[model samples]
Target chain A: DTAVSQTPKYLVTQMGNDKSIKCEQNLGHDTMYWYKQDSKKFLKIMFSYNNKELIINETVPNRFSPKSPDKAHLNLHINSLELGDSAVYFCASSDSRTGFGEQYFGPGTRLTVT
Target chain B: QQQVKQSPQSLIVQKGGISIINCAYENTAFDYFPWYQQFPGKGPALLIAIRPDVSEKKEGRFTISFNKSAKQFSLHIMDSQPGDSATYFCAASKGGGSTLGRLYFGRGTQLTVWP
Candidate 1:
C-alpha cells in the first residue's frame, strides 16, 4: 500500500503558466509538507501543515501556494511559474501524535517549466 | 542558511565493503535524526532513525551513529551490495514550536555500489 501518493508524476509546462499538484496520504498523519529538490539534489522545505492548519512557511516565493483541504490532502499551486521553478516537488507526511519525526514521502512530481 | 550539512557528494563502494556518510547540524534543539534512501524515479524512504538520547541505532545492515555534543551523525552501511546504490539523505527535526515536525534535509550523497 502506498502511504503517500502524488498525481501527474511528470509535469511539463511553459513559462508564466499556472500549475497544480495534488497529494494524498493514507497513513493518517496530521502533518503534511511540501519540498522542492533542485537539479543539484538539494532538498528544501517550502510549507508545512498540521491538522489542516498552516504551521511552517519557509523562504519560498509568494507565487507558490500550498493548500490543505483536509488533514489527508495537501495541494500545491504555482502562479506564473518561472524556469527556476523547474524541479522535483515531493509531498510528505508524518504523524504528529507520535512526535518521532519520521516522514513518509510521495513519489514526487517532476515539474519542468520551459 | 543550510541547517543540515552532509559531506561527500558522491561515493562508490564495492560489494562486501562498508559505506559511510556523515552529516552535521547547528541546531542544538534537534533531537531526532533520520536517514532516508532514494532511488531513481522514487521518493526517499526512511532507512533508520536515531534519537539524541541514544548514541547509536542499528537495523540490519544499516546503522546510525549520533553524537549530541558535536551535533554530528553518520550512517554506515555494512556489506553493501549493488542493490544498495542510491541517494542517501540525512535529516534532523526538533520536537516543539512552529518548526515542530519540520525536517531539514541534507544536500544528499549519491552512492554507487559496484558488484
Candidate 2:
C-alpha cells in the first residue's frame, strides 16, 4: 500500500485557472505538511497541520490555501494560479509522538501553469 | 537569512568512491539535522538524520557527522553506487526534540555517480 499518496500526479492548467491537489496518508500520523519544489530543486515548506489544526504557514501567496479535514488527509487549493506557481508539490507526514520524526513523503504532484 | 546552507550545487563521483556533502546552519535552535534523497518525479525520502547530542551516527553505508559547536553537519556515503545517484537535500528543524518537526531545507545537491 502507498503510505503517502497524492492525486493528479501531473497538473497542467492555463494561467489564472484554479486547481487543487489532494493528499492522503495511511501511516496514521498526526502531522501533515505541504511543500513546493521549484525548478532549482529548492524544497520549501508551505503549510503544516497537526491533527487538523494549522501549525505552520510560510510566506506563501494568498492564492494558496491548505485544508486538512482530518488527521489523515491534507489538501492544497490554489486559485488564480500564476506562471510562477509551476513546481512539484509534495505532501509529507510524520508521527507527532516521535522525537525528530522521520517524514514520509508522497510521490508528488507536478503542476505546470502555462 | 538562509537558515541552512549546503555546499556544491552538484557533485559527481565514481562508483565505489566516497561521497561527502556538507551543510552549515545559522540557527542555534536547530538541533536535528536530516539528509533526504530524491529521484526524478519523486519526493525526498529521509536517508539519515542526527541530533546535536551525538557527534556521529551511522546507518549501513551512510553516515552523518555533526559538530554542535560549529553548527555544521555532513553526510558521507561510503561505497557510492550508481543507484544512489539522486538529488540530496540537507535540512534542519527547531523543537525537533519536542516534536515541532517542520524542516527547513537547503538547496539540494544533484549527485551523479558514474559507473
Task: Categorize the docking of model 1.
Answer: medium
* TM-scores of the models, in the order given: 0.97, 0.96
User: Can you tell me the DockQ of model 2?
Assistant: 0.60
State the lDDT at B33 in candidate 2: 90
Candidate 1 wrongly placed segments (more than 4 Å): none
- For candidate 2, the per-residue lDDT at B80 reads 99
| Model 2 lDDT per residue over B31-86, tens place | 67989999988889999899899999999999999998888899999999999999
Against the true structure, candidate 1 has what lDDT?
Answer: 0.93
Which 10 residues in a row give candidate 2 chain B its minimum summed lDDT?
B93-102
Instruction: Report DockQ per prediction, comma-separated.
Output: 0.78, 0.60
Model 2 over residues A1-111: C-alpha lDDT tens digits?
A: 999999999999999899999999999999999999899999888998888988888899989999999999999999999999999999999987884348999999999
- Can you give the lDDT of residue B41 in candidate 2? 80
